[model samples]
Target: MSAPTATARRSRTRWFALGAVAVAGAAFVAISVSGIGDNLVYYWGPKELRAAGDKAVGATIRLGGQVAPGSIKPGDGVSNLEFDVTDGTALVHVVATGVPPQLFRDRIGVVVEGTMTRGGTFEGHRLLVSHDNKYRAPADKNVDIKTLMRSTAGLEER
Candidate 1:
């Protein structure tokens, strides 16, 4: 076969470039769409999670609920904490490995992320606390306005 002419060489180069672009685009689409539906993290409250029963096991999920009052307790390790999360209709015991936030308290809203074990307990790796967006002043009527003003008078810039 004779050496390819400049025009023929350019045509082959153009076709190769198009083929490379097509392969890259296909790879990108396949990666972006692969099993994302199956890999999605489930968000479930205690009730819904418990209702799901066997299907809940081994599934990565975010469980949101109130920290059941009087349920917070230390576990085997100093960093390990155990508590029951309740949605008022059901409860899921969570054994987590991490220092819970200082704001963690009874009846406070919390969300734990992890998977449910076959033993029906949630093995959490992360915890988050929900907090109010606005702050409200304490309601105290016993403070004398004159005394309060006098106490704060020294704090004002001279």
Candidate 2:
């Protein structure tokens, strides 16, 4: 073919490159869309999660709330841990076999990532605790407000 019709060859090469890019882009989009359905993440409170009926099984989700006080129980054997997560109104049982975070404790905000079991328990593979905001104070009505005000006087307004 030699060097004949240089402009025609250049135009053909450009079209081929453009077509290849378009095909690759389309394939990427298709794969992404298909994978998204399996990766859908839903956040639900403890009570709301229990109300999800049978549809909760086989679906991955995040249980967001505090671990219920006095509801934490270590597994009977050596490999599992069971606990109840509560959002004040409702509580759901959580069964996890993996090692949980060190900060996991009662009355602390936590988000457990895992799939729900058919027996109405969440099996967490990962436990994420929201440890940034934790304040402990007695709920007595007789607490001295004057001392609290004095202690916070030097702090900047947040």
Candidate 3:
């Protein structure tokens, strides 16, 4: 029998430290993956929702589409709203409760977050309006810049 040398002890210590670090890293990755999976909310459009069939029911998902031109209607409650969201191919009826955003209107793109009911209606709790970033000149383009500047010039010093 013989006692271990100083070099042997240092090598063993290094291996042990390396193993601990690997275990910690694995644990962190596992935790992060699980957290992300739990928080994930799948987004579906009208066509996708139709394709989902039974799977879409009872699942909390996000639906994105444009509000149908003539489908906005008052629901059973004051704040309740019913509208058809369409992606030009399919339409899904959405019933939402809460204050609709100012930009929420017919023909505007929207994304609603909620669960779909068994009766084929989406019960939404949150509403998001989508608008394009295209910029255009105003229709009334005859404004005189010098006159406008003169009007505000007196107030600029204040």
Writing each residue's lDDT as its tens digit, candidate 3 over 1-158 gives 24578778889999999999999999999878768744453467788888889898987889988788789997776567999988777899999988788977777768899988889899999988766443335675765533332211112222
lDDT of every model, 2 decimals: 0.76, 0.70, 0.76
TM-scores, all models, native as reference: 0.59, 0.55, 0.60
- Cα error of candidate 1 at position 91, Å: 0.8
Superposed by TM-score, candidate 1 places the C-alpha of residue 106 at a distance from the truth, in angstroms, of 0.6
Count clashing residue pairs in model 2.
Answer: 0
- Give the range where candidate 1 is weakest over 10 consecutive residues by summed lDDT: 149-158
lDDT of 2: 0.70
Superior by TM-score: candidate 1 or candidate 3: 3
Report the C-alpha displacement of residue 102, candidate 2, in angstroms.
Answer: 1.5
Clashes of each: 0, 0, 0
Give per-residue CA lDDT, model 2, range 1-158, as digits (tens): 55768878999999999999999999999778878634554457777688887877887788877677778888866346878877667888888767677877766667888888888778887777765322447896665643332211111121
Best by lDDT: 3
TM-score of 1: 0.59
* Clashing pairs for predicted structure model 3, backbone only: none
Between candidates 2 and 3, the one scoring higher on lDDT is 3
